[model samples]
Target chain A: MTDSSQVYVREVGPRDGLQHEQTWLDTADKLNWIEQLGEAGLTYIEITSFVSPSWIPALADADEVARTLKKSPGVTYAALVPNRKGLERALLANIDEVAIFLSASETHNQKNINADTESALARLSRVAEEARQSGKAVRGYLSMAFGCPYEGKVEVDEVERLAERLFEMGVTELSLGDTIGIAGPKQIEAVISRLGRMIPLERLALHPHNTYGTGLANIYAAFQLGIRRFDGSTGGIGGCPYARGASGNVATEDLVYLMQTLGAKTGNDLVRLTSSAQWIEKRLGRPLPSSQLQLSKEEGRCL
Target chain B: MTDSSQVYVREVGPRDGLQHEQTWLDTADKLNWIEQLGEAGLTYIEITSFVSPSWIPALADADEVARTLKKSPGVTYAALVPNRKGLERALLANIDEVAIFLSASETHNQKNINADTESALARLSRVAEEARQSGKAVRGYLSMAFGCPYEGKVEVDEVERLAERLFEMGVTELSLGDTIGIAGPKQIEAVISRLGRMIPLERLALHPHNTYGTGLANIYAAFQLGIRRFDGSTGGIGGCPYARGASGNVATEDLVYLMQTLGAKTGNDLVRLTSSAQWIEKRLGRPLPSSQLQLSKEEGRCL
Candidate 1:
């Protein structure tokens, strides 16, 4: 079900990354950074989340960001929408796609969105249907699919159940998130291979965090299993606000470098991708977690 | 030729990591840190390098460290010996093993050790023989085996040639180093698969840097190719001084995590290993590059 030769990297830095950051880039800086990411050949970018400002003040200007940013041809600008209100706001802003998320573990679901698994699914189902009816694609995110901080070692059957429900709700793709970054290659293989029996592999993407430094290896293991889509933050600058010790998502620059070295086409320019990371790092006023960015800063050149 | 059920983790932090560090720990701290490492279930540790004080002032107390560190029951204490003089010092210290290194690329060899490849190999040939004759195990490190800073992509043919020569010199095992941390899964697959045809895979190890963030993935690729031995630093603290932009080695805690997840026995307690990393991080007065260490510091517990 996967394209054996190509990888689709979805940039989540502007949404997932910024949401957890203490430093807030202004709407203008966010727009400019998103533009730089697109110019670096990232075709898919989750630009913002249409959640309540009180919940995530860092990305409070989601509507403004989505409506005002100039959309590039061949680039899909997505947004995370939590509920019907967020979806309405997203549709108003003409967002390209709407991503809805729930956790595989019940405790994590309640902790993350203040809803139990069943209610969260019911709510996301409505949101998914509404977004689809509005002629937009819906992407589902199953966080803590690997291991839950509250409930350790999420069962693969539970993951499959949630994933199937999302797919049944008319979602085109399901991104399995290692919310705490605890999954390794064995866990990736076990979960993805089990899930592959129930769904098309192409419809699945990996959203891995580098918390335990196994993100890339886990991604590689999934790629070997015919997974083609991956989620990465530009500077590896996002983690679950609820998952303690969860570090940044795998950096987009490092992901591109890994894909390129593995002989897969990601349509990303490494130098430009690294430069975009640098731009965001400078605005963040602290070093980002991406190894490529660190190397570039150290040597004053893209490796 | 390969052990499918076990992973040999060789700790190179004290030698390779401390050698590049800006802050030099006193000899007592180095000894204490190394003893802690051995107690944490690391069976092999390259404690320090017997290089000139002028070359690496940080590890100037190499002889003292090699002599003073309390050896654990199953631990093999090793040191990097540059030549006959270093080997003599190592022998006098009763080092359990002596590691000799040269670069696979001529320019890197010249820049790293101020000697050409052929001459460096010639010098190491004597060191390897002398170490073996002295009844200590001999380890050979081939730096820039993946990619070189000045030479870019290193030819696998050259790697094989150099590797065969080192094996001919009676070294027990050869560790191929990604000095710049630029190689990824494909390069690892290509180089290691080719070399496996010429030499026994069990006699080979991977010394990967996390510069480009593909260190664990590269190690995973090598492991899949029947490699069991890996070189890592406790806190991911070391890089090649000669290779610009080179970052830390793959963290020992992270490596153990990966290997354990892959169903291989590394005999390491992740908590103890991470605590050791934190211990070193404090003494260094800054964060080490290990993701596990960072996560532990953030969560106040080992992930």
Candidate 2:
């Protein structure tokens, strides 16, 4: 990004990355990767969520992972906190930002927090407001905002109403979630255009899964629409804990590759990113769910 | 499409789909699939190729497969023919159309056909002229027109020049290739926009491989630009043989999914298409690569 108005990539490996890790990441390895990502020039990093340990045992050392890292001066670290209990734990970690997630789909909300959409929104609003009182910036994640694999097509009005309510509740930003990676450019345009009317562009971020492998293309659509913040995972970490057969979050390396090519400023080394991804691939006992990572490693192959 | 314009979907599974399979399809299975796809309202079914048996013995049953099927009256059964030898063989079969392929990159052309771009063009032109003289509509396959796996970024002028030359060679239509599948919407626009300027949109089509999984999105861009004809395989069948690690062609069912969702008309039945995909998936010992196929089988999922 040569322009002063550049995009920021929020690295979600620490939280989204380890959530689905079959093999628990040793605290040392977690801290090591966190430190590396910090040095790699990520302006925003999501360290870990303060969700229940039983739900995500992989992130049990969330507080330790947060405290062990040497903070990159200008970088902000955020964590996902479900409600008051999760927020208390995140507050103890002294994180710069916290995120509250609520679903646009009623079923997802019912399953997510065991509350209906209305109740989930009320609880999320309270959490965001209370977190604001403590002077911590809160981001509201509206999951299944585009289309849920569970519920099929989610209404844009439902997404917009929730986003407006979140913004009113003192949340710093609204991140639209395409949980199952079913969104395309047209859908992105439709949802974002509607949300852009309801919410401020600066207050909007996007979290797109690469399930259908359209993550990068969807990001381009958002970029064209002047969206400057996006959520990505290192090595495409973090499979959906709730959704079955869903792809991981958009690969950080692929995001960087597309952004850098399209003139978005992200100070990530392609070679190092691919190597780190390869390391994660080995740990996961599978190929990285990143087309860019695989394409990069095929040495001497022209494309 | 609500417009008077119509889109033609060419099924390339028989030729492109089975080319990489080591397991030679039962001649009966091949014939059954061709018949099934024809019933699905495919306008142009690429039945088989007349390549050397030594190179692609999996498709050695092409002659038998072509002669045995019940040809749908309005549907064109096209065959891939690389040179004079392949063309002669295809002409002897029940082939309604013959497609000649020439690579855009000199390196790809040399590696793929042991001929440079010019020589390969000359050979294809000669074959196209011969097929036209025999009253067969000749479709030209311009491989790697977007990007070559063997030679990175292909030039638009070169692609446009070759496409124009192919038109002059008595070709019926052109299918621009995304052989390596590195193309995004902007690149798709650049190619079609340039080609649309040189040649009429009526004679243009897109043949995208899903290596990077942007095939559907690229197809969306193509449709948006008023270029309707496309090539896809059942169950996302074939990958570029030379481009190791690259993905197979986009699945016909998945393409139909995108087209139908956009409110375009296609004569394919999703349920039956899904079943056919599953049948091939069992034979290939892998799940179908189409996103919609997997999503469909999941109890709660929909695309």
Candidate 3:
């Protein structure tokens, strides 16, 4: 089981949040936003993706983002690397951490990265090895671990098998992404309990989207089951571009408020986090879907 | 712990959902809305408040609303009764159940009902007795059980003492209201654990507001601790009139989606419930905050 005394929230706003939007923020705006998030007391951030710019034009300036981030002391900046090429780019940018991705469902894996489950893991295994040899921490993301838009009701055993393989391949952490947010507390408990038998709970993190409004509840269920690390986006940005009407990742302020109120030590300051969410939402020219940010601003309370 | 296999969702759209709104729904609209809710498979519904018209002019048509209801079989239709006078009105309207309200915090009690804590309980005690004599189910609500807007954090012992008094006063069910939505899972666990020792789990229910976006999380926490009954409003209507930016009860669709997805039988049809939410939201002439309702309409999925 993971540590019960503390929780680490990895802010994925710059990468996960920005990737799904129709609008794009230039490199300068991205830099300013990332700096604000860095100052907001995030201990770990998924800063950008090193995948081909042609694929993710929104984060096309991944190299610039990695190099320009005024690396905050004690904060780990991680970037997603699809393969050896992306890993080399990350190495050039001097990234703190590199992440590789696969999926529990074969259909989702093929649809997401144009590879079968085995082929995707094979690619990530090589990348993970090279990234570890290069001395950068490696994180693995198992997308659609709960349910897939292409394949509904992902099996817990499949997730466990994939997770074990990722851990064996030198991934320091495995983030289970509920890509379409179809997870409920019961399913979360069942999945985490099954995975805990194969992997140390501390090496697992949960990244839930709020599609059915069960994101926070699912996260809380995981927390109670002793998973400490969580992935959230500021202002609740980034829905699954593949799933219709899927909302963004659970809002950072909402998660922070729940964790803080439950007496969990999250180090991140709520006031500063809200300001950063507000700033980004303004830049997006629309209101973000964060309830805590809205309440904290409208009510003027220090929640 | 409460039973995990089955959950009861008591819809409070006509009462709690509409009470805080600036716009008023006439008796005909209220009747139509309540009928829609009843037909949508809700086993329990809080129809209206039978308080003095001056106190809650929004629900001033309580008598007419109660009289016109089609009265679905096997459904418990309830109304809020502030005192003996209100109970008498409910009795005349042949309400299936009558609910009484008090506050765990004296300041909130005074501000909300213009009575001190002890005085409000005294009044409710008489109403509970009268309703019991008339063979009507009685529910007692303890507002601000988690926190109070006027007086910050409320003590667990204070809530325990209040719940005990309400249960002793012949209230069939006791609802602990997170009036300001300041509750976290730890506080919910602490409070429910203490109350569980004094009262049966079946007699206890949770009424959470989504002010801090902890509403569903709190409900999930309570559900994990064996609470089987919950109170929610359609389309997540109404905010706390006393607390700034305090949202309505956790939306019925959100709660239904969660419990149903968790494999707990709610006996409420998700598709029909969502249509009711959309219908009422249209009546209100604005978007309601229910993520489930919004997603169902936009995604065209039968959640």
Supply DockQ values for each candidate: 0.49, 0.27, 0.43
Give the lDDT ranking, best first: 1, 3, 2
Report lDDT (Cα) of residue A301, candidate 1: 30
Show pairs that collide, candidate 2.
A1-A264, A1-A265
Candidates 1 and 3 compared by lDDT, better number: 1
Residue range B50-126, candidate 1, lDDT tens digits: 88999889999988888777888999888999989988888888999888888898987777778888888888888
lDDT digits (tens) for residues B1-303 of candidate 3: 444678999888889888877678878889888888888789999999988888778998999989888888988999998888888889999999988888899887777777888888778788888889999989888888988877898998899988989988988888989876888888999999999997989999999888778788889899888899999998888765443334567999899888887778898888888889888878878667787776765533311
Question: What are the per-residue Cα lDDT tens digits for candidate 2 across B1-303?
Answer: 235345678899888888877566788888888888877777789988888888789888777777777888888898998888888878788589998888889898888778888888788878888888888889998889988766688899889888888889988789898877778777888899998886878788899987765677678778878888888988888854444344578888878877765667777776777677777777767544665555555554322
- TM-score of the first chain of model 3: 0.95
C-alpha RMSD of each candidate structure in angstroms? 2.5, 3.1, 2.6
- The docking quality of candidate 1, as DockQ, is 0.49
Candidate 2 ranges beyond 4 A from true positions: A1-5, A20-23, A149-151, A240-246, A260-263, A296-303, B1-6, B240-246, B286-288, B296-303
Model 3 ranges with Cα > 4 A deviation: A1-3, A240-246, A299-303, B1-4, B240-246, B299-303
* Model 1 chain A lDDT-worst window of ten: A239-248
Worst window of 10 by summed lDDT in candidate 3 chain A: A294-303
